[model samples]
Target: MADITGIPPQSIDPDQALWPNAGTIRSSNQTNAAGQAGNAEKPTANNKDGIYVKDRLEDKDVKPEKIIFSNKLEASTYLKLQQLATYGGENIQEILEAALTAYFVGKEEASRPLPPKVLAVLRKKYPFL
Candidate 1:
């Protein structure tokens, strides 16, 4: 194949390979003037996994960690959610959180203090309470 192409496949010396991050994905957040990421060669605790982006907290801009949650909803329900978001000029997350908060608050209003006897039994069963 090399002879047909008139080019030879030269072996690469690992130590002298330029652009160390040539094949790895890199974000715009971290890159040197040479377009190579700075810490690709070393595997630190943060870079141990495949994720190689800089820690946002290190930049003094902390954001709440978000966990992905998803469930199948009816097509109508999904469409309504999108329409509500657009109408309110808010994302579905904000709308859903607000709705859940209101629901919890409404449910909490129905709560009544435990009876003395029940409280006594609970206290006896669980001293911490």
Candidate 2:
């Protein structure tokens, strides 16, 4: 389609096409150019450093600024999650929260004090441990 200035759409500059972050999303915080946002669910409080932080689990309804990248596996997982949410008649955000909670719970468990046997093996394998 022709734009108002009668310029036809063309491919992005070749140099930009191969740039490392070409497909990466940028947040407004990274730029001096004032940006605008639309009606996303609002976020909660901010720290003295001006970053938003949700203090309560109930604040899940409040949207926060973030970015995520996906490959085939992650994209497939999200698609399956979306399907499950549709089948269960639930919001995708709630499903996402459940998934995040499960992931973190595993992480927390993995962080607990290791058994003496495991620690001995690890320490033997890597003296820095």
Candidate 3:
């Protein structure tokens, strides 16, 4: 992947496009015109910027899953969501997935308990201190 294939479809100055104009890569805390400091540096497989793409951090291919949204968000809200995603260096899909997952996990943890047999086994394996 490191091997550059000629040039990209559009000319990209890595320093200008992704990095600061400084001679070397600047700190993640450095601010850009978009005002995104890229605070979180959990690297992804693609590793575009330092900010974490919660879903991509696992180094797994993002399976293309299609689902239709009701598109209920107001236009301004949608734009803000896009801007936040861009500024935070997150994939919008991953952000949504993380939100959905957290919601479901929270509900599941509260509503669903493991079978008594499993709990017993765990208790036996490691006694409560």
Error of 1 at 38 (Å): 29
* Residues 11-59, model 2: lDDT tens digits: 7887556553322222334342123222223455666645455334343
Question: lDDT, candidate 3, residue 67?
Answer: 33
Higher-scoring candidate on TM-score, 1 or 2: 1
Q: Is candidate 1 or candidate 3 better by TM-score?
A: 1
Which residue pairs in candidate 2 collide?
A: none
List candidate 2 segments past 4 Å from native. Answer: 1-73, 106-129
**TM-score, cand. 1:** 0.32
Q: Pick the candidate with the highest TM-score.
A: 1
lDDT of 3 by residue, 1-129 (tens): 335676546667875676443222122333442343344345454467654464342433323343324447789977876766556665566667787778887475757777899878866755551
Q: lDDT scores for all predictions?
A: 0.56, 0.52, 0.53
Residue pairs with backbone atoms closer than 3 Å in model 1 (clashes):
none
Cα displacement (angstroms), candidate 1, residue 96, comes to: 0.4
Per-candidate clash tally: 0, 0, 0
Model 1: per-residue Cα lDDT at residue 30: 41
lDDT of 1 by residue, 1-129 (tens): 698998888889784485344333233234332454454444335555554344323532223353335689899998888666545545566677787777778575547778899889977766655
Return the candidate ranking by TM-score, descending: 1, 3, 2
Clash list (residue pairs), candidate 3: none
Off by over 4 Å in 3: 1-70, 108-129
